[model samples]
Target: MTLKTEPFVLNMGPVHPSTHGVFRMRVVLDGEVVTDMEPVFGYLHRGIEKLAEERTYGGIIPLTDRLDYIAAMSNNFGYVLSVEKLAGIKVPERAEYIRVIMAELQRIASYLIIIGAFLNECGAYFTPFVYMFREREKIIDLFEMVSGQRLTYNYMRVGGVSQDLPEEFLPALDKFLAQMPVCIDEYDRLLKENEILLARSKGVGILSKETAINGSVTGPALRGSGVKWDIRRADPYSIYDRFEFDIPTGSAGDCYDRYRVRVEEMRQSLRIIKQAREQMPAGPVRTKVPHLVRPPVGETYAHIETPKGELGFYLVSDTSISPYRIHIRAPSLINLTVLRELIIGWKIADLFVIFGSIDLTMGEVDR
Candidate 1:
């Protein structure tokens, strides 16, 4: 005699530890395997675009900080660059270098959380998370030294940065730069070869090159799929063209490959920062601009490589102090598009592993 079984429905989040934030995945499971998934979001939505329409051009900078809260500096850079391009404002050369420095530092801090969170989801306990958090504090200290805020740094401005780098910030940054490589090497030795981690993550949730590009997945997720497309390399913005760094790509396009891509990216970010520091010149951090900035009647779009992916800001101006329409090309939301395709054949236990590997922040996904 034989018994018949039916698929059961399970809710993964909306408020679960591994979901990362108010994200929910309605998964249909046949025993332990996930057969189908419906991703449900909007729990954390704040209507940021509508708010941007109401705020002054300068006032919207702080609003951007809330998008990818983990990497607010990148959000600031994208929005300010869009506004500057629309208004024809020229940033000071020194300010450009400072911007690059801050952006790279933010990148490192964001990746520490991402990799740490991924390992945590893999059931490695708190060891890796705590270690990465310790290093992240040093970078946060650097940001505080310059921006006066730890998480939501509203330091970027229309024509330049809010202020110049302080006297002590450089020496602190130098110390961090000197120590970061050793920490990275230690982390690699600790986790990369663990037999358990390998068994769980290797070749799981594979996203092909064709799928990644067609789905518009960018940043480390796209790079992990063997597509060497980086916004900084493909489309140079600010002083990125002047600096030297390599775009890291993965061949397997699996969960492990995504993890490896982020690790290599941190190294590349450090390289760019070192070059920017050496080439940094002395000058004012900002150019003079009116309190109420009204750009010409036009539309503009600008994007930056944030920790999650390519974050873009699009604006329509009517020659007013506020934008006529504003839209954000949020990578978190776009990357989620491919989730169903990747998780279909994996087991329920592998669900969170694959999800964490994507490195999404719900704030941006629901924004």
Candidate 2:
């Protein structure tokens, strides 16, 4: 049996600049309405997971950084958590606080990118984008100071972090924190109530709570869809339970809701950063371990709340210096699970708005 229908077909991306990265959308349209959508990936398959088997335990940390490339510290933290649990390594309290600080700071930085880029896609041009970056640059400066490198930070180790907080790090971080709230407000004034942004995003790309769960969506995407679920709170790890913050969620699960959820999430992350900085203790950054790191034959799955969503690492060890199997359950990939459903029955222009609202990173999605 065969059922065929005529639908105007077109490609959304693969080489388009607005895709944010190497992403292709196969779109079926009827006049101005979308009929169906399929996302195509694999343009940037670096094979890092398979390569992890060949590298030593210590060698894989830097490779994890390339997975998300946005929240590099959170990627590093999740991988190290699985490895540490597998090897029975106890990270010092001080190191854990440092990890939390870095993770939260990176989370804020990641949201800044999303807000700026999403506004740009909404056709607000450079005004909002520039406003978002002004705060993000300060966070990047903090990363550079501590890690000795910015984007591809190789500052994570299996047992713990690779470096201690620099002498100037805390004071600089405090200054950035004091200045960030005003910057976030500036972004609010620019796009929050703008009729253009609201009209484009408010009712577009609605996803229900139940559907969001079945699709395995996590992070802000799930929250935006009216699910008050956060992996950080649901499955607290690495002293995250110690922090006091609210999980901001939405009711309509539309593009506007997604935008609002992430904005509130950025504010929550800032709160976590302040708490971590105020309660920081002085101690060693990394745990003592052998040069040739190996874990007993076992498996461990460690998950953390990355800026994008629940970033998890599944590691199986066979008592070798490298993992026998590594599975990166990236939230960006899971969040894209519902793109087809959201794009249907909408205008082709809404495709741009919906994708931007989802806030995906091609690195994690394709990984």
Candidate 3:
């Protein structure tokens, strides 16, 4: 005779390891399987949008640094581009190249954290995390050499970067570019085919292509769902059109495919950086803009492909030093919309593995 069981709810996080940050998951479990789920967020909200209205256009850059703090440079890129569009500011050629370089570097760095953290959630101990962080440290060192900040670079500004690359920066970057591919391969060799990781991740928590697009997911998560939409390729921000890179996609849209998409994206990011370094021209890194940047009363939207997804900034300027209104089309928030659908039928233990594959940053979600 079969025993009857009622659904039981399990609340994980708002302060759990696999939530990544202050995020909560309300799960209804029928024994070991998840029958329904609700993603709870806003535990780390800082009112960044409300705060942007109170600050000058230039002052808003630093605040953007906090959103998706892992890919802070990409946050800077989106906000600055929106401001530049509103103000009719033109970025210098060299600054465009520098912005691409910094953004791509941030992409690889952020992916490192994603891959490492996902493996840890999959119960790989800390081995993969340690290996990825070793390479990530080199990229961070290169960023610090130019911007003098390790985590929040605040390096991009409207119409260009805050400053030019130091003379030594390029050579050091050249060294990093030379070594990153080998390190990536080493990660693949170490854990990509481990039976346990594959058992936990492969064919698990599959997100459909239609659901991903309709849900407004972007970046690797969307790409992992077999969608070929990358803002860099789709919208052509900055000099992205000038550079050539492949949009990597996955077949199954499962946790393993998401992992593969990010890993392949790191390789593609390296390719873009290499070509940018070879083709970059020498010129002023910034264009002059007044301290009080009063854009003509207008509205504009700008977005870039961050590690997590499409990060966009929409601005309404009223011919003042501060924006009349600002809205962030945060990828982290939008990507979580399908969380319940993805995990509803999966086992309870697979929940964190699937969540980690989505790779969210709570700062952006709560912003």
Candidate 4:
């Protein structure tokens, strides 16, 4: 005799642990396999774009920090770049180099958090998570030295950084750069080829290159689908053109490929930071701009290769202290366009691993 199975509906979370941050997925399951899925967002929405209209251009810097709280520096970088363009401001040479260093360091730190959380979702639990966080904490220490805040660092300004690096910042950064490679290698040696990880993630949750592109996915997710597009190389922003680094792409676009891309990207970030450090010059970190910046009546858009993906900002000014309109091209939300397709037909157990591999923070999604 054979037993018949019926389909059931399940709500993964607006509160469940694996949704990453206030995200929910409504799934239709036939036993252990997910037959259909719908992603639910906006649980954490705060109407940030609307708020930008009320705040001065400079004041909006703090607001951007809240967009991707995990990679706040990159959020600040992208927003300030847009504001600078609208105002026709030029950043100082030294400030350009400093921005590159801070942005690259933030990339590594943000990747570390996602990688740790991804592994934890895969069932390795807090052991690997704690190990990765150990390195992330060191990066946080360096950030704290410069910005005095571990997270939500409103460090970048319209024409440059808000302040110069403190006396001990470089020495501390040097120490971190020296030790980070060893830690990365250690992580690779321990988990990269582990049988359990390979079995769990190797060929699961495959996203096709065409699907990724058509859906407008960017960053590691798009690159993991074997696309060689990186905004730093495709469209050079700041002093990224002055640096030498390789864009890492994955072949199969599976969970393992996305995981591998992030790990390799961390190494590339270290390379960029090293070049920025050696080529940095001494000059005023911030350009002289009015306290209340009033750009001519016009609009501008600026984007940067943030840790998760391409984060872009669009700003419109009407010669006022505050912006007339603001819109953020948030990668976290854009990248989720293909989530339902990726999750459908996969086992319930693989759902968390697949979703975690995308590496999205709800702060950006709900904004």
Candidate 5:
């Protein structure tokens, strides 16, 4: 004789705010407990890869800025590094140091937004998100000072950065750094040990180490799953090898650990910025590149640890001013793979906690 069991399936996204963007999860449940889940994509497809084939080398920089809009500096840095590799351009030492500092600041700002937004999703109200962005505003101020534009600062060129750091940039950065520890402490005080947050996040959405890597998780999300792999340290590209910082890892691989990883990462990023600022060289911010670049027929891939995760830019050049092909290995899109898998067997309310903990951006995922 055989026994029969029924399965329940539900869709958690494609329109859910907590999904971070327009994405969906097909979940199968067994008696109010999810048994299996699959994450669906292509909702916000813009065919960016197809679009890149037609844009010139310089023109592609602006588009790269949109990939992980939160960490625009790092996105540009990683993409331009690939182009530089392809072009065999030499960057000044000062330019490398300046790039590191700006990228670190953007990392901190992006994490602040995720933390505030994650906390808000747990129904703690809007206070934290508002408070978080307040600090973010100051960081954006620094970016504006350095590049003359906030958000999508077209401040990176194929060879090096577009401009030198402003004279006031250091002072602003220092001031922001001094205040960050206190703000971090405030967040810890507000939600770290709070019973509600702890309950909602702890032991929820667990991802094992093997599963994390199998699903191609990176950055804090992979660390949360107990992997010590960080592209910045493992690969040590750019001036990252000159720096000393800790790669924080988590044991539980839950929402809480992911949250902690990013929080600690912010602290580490601050340390990198301070070190970079103190050691910043005095010279031109940009390397010399042709107004129009025509590279030898070749292809290269560059990966960097963005605020979200590993952001890799793959370019194929056919010795033309415009790239023959371009591909963005986006973190958000890859991180979402295990999203439904983690949320299954959990309550619908817990979906937001899991989704926000992964820390996604539509700009990158859609692109």
Candidate 6:
């Protein structure tokens, strides 16, 4: 006699730890295998775009901080770049180098979170997670020296950074740059060739290159699928054209490839920061502008290679202090478009690894 099986739906989260942040997944399962999945968003939405319309251009920087709280510096960079373009503001040379250094440091810090969380989801538990955070804390200390905030640093301003790096900031950053590569190497020695990690992640949840580009995935996720596209390299912004760094790509497009790409990218971030440090000159950090910026009636969009992915802000001005309309092309939400394609037919346990590989923060997704 043959037994009959029926598919059942399991709700993964709106509050579970593995969902990253208040995200939900309705999974159609056949026993332990996921047959279909629907990602549920909005649990964390705070109408950030709508709120931007009510705040002045300068005031909106804090709101962007809450979008991708893990990489708040990148959020600030993207928004300020958009506002500067809208107002035709020119940033100083020193400020541009400072921006590059901060942005690159933010990229490294954000990738640490992703790598740690991904390894944790793969069942390495807190060992790797804590190790990653140890380095991240050093980066955070450097940010605090400049921004005076541990998280949600509202550091980037409309013209440039809120202020020049403090007297001690560069020295702290130089120390970090010197020691970070050794730490990265230590992480590699510990887990890069672990048998268990290889078994769990390699050759799992592959996303094709064509699908990634068509879905508009960016950053490491797109690069993980063997696409050699990076906003910093593809379309230089600020003084990114002045720096030399390599874009890392993965061939298999699997969980392991994504993890490897992030690790390699961290090294590249260090390279960029080192160059910025060597090239940075002394000048005024912020350009003088009206207390309340009222751009000419026009619209502009600016995108940056945020740690999670490509974060773009589109602003429309009606010659007002506040934005006439604000729209965010949040990578967290866009990258989720490929979830169903990646998770279906995999075991429920594999779902976490695949999802974590994308490195999304629900704040950006639901915002």
Work out the TM-score per prediction: 0.99, 0.97, 0.98, 0.98, 0.95, 0.99
Local accuracy of candidate 1 as per-residue lDDT tens digits, 191-241 = 999987898889999999999989999889999999989889898999899
Q: In order, what lDDT does every prediction score? A: 0.93, 0.88, 0.91, 0.92, 0.86, 0.92
Cα error, candidate 6, residue 360 (Å)? 0.8
RMSD of each: 0.9, 2.4, 1.3, 1.3, 2.2, 0.9
Q: For candidate 5, what is the TM-score?
A: 0.95
Residue pairs with colliding backbones in model 4 are none
Candidate 3 deviant stretches above 4 angstroms: 1-4
**Better structure of 2 and 6 per lDDT:** 6
Those runs of model 6 whose alpha carbons end farther than 4 Å from true positions after fitting are 1-3
Error of 4 at 97 (Å): 1.0
Inter-residue clash pairs, candidate 5: 14-23, 34-345
What residue runs in model 1 are displaced by over 4 Å at the alpha carbon? 1-3
Best by lDDT: 1
For 162-194, candidate 4 gives per-residue lDDT tens digits of 889999989988999999999999999978988
Which ranges in model 2 have alpha carbons more than 4 Å from their true place? 1-6
CA error at residue 283 for candidate 3, angstroms:
1.5
TM-score for candidate 4: 0.98
Clashes of 2: 0
Q: How far is candidate 4 from the true structure (C-alpha RMSD, Å)?
A: 1.3
Candidate 4 lDDT trough over 10 residues, lowest sum: 12-21
Regions of candidate 5 where Cα sits further than 4 Å from its true position: 1-9, 29-32
lDDT of 3 by residue, 244-362 (tens): 88999999999999999999999999999999999999989888888799999889988888898888899998898899899999999998998889999888889989999998899
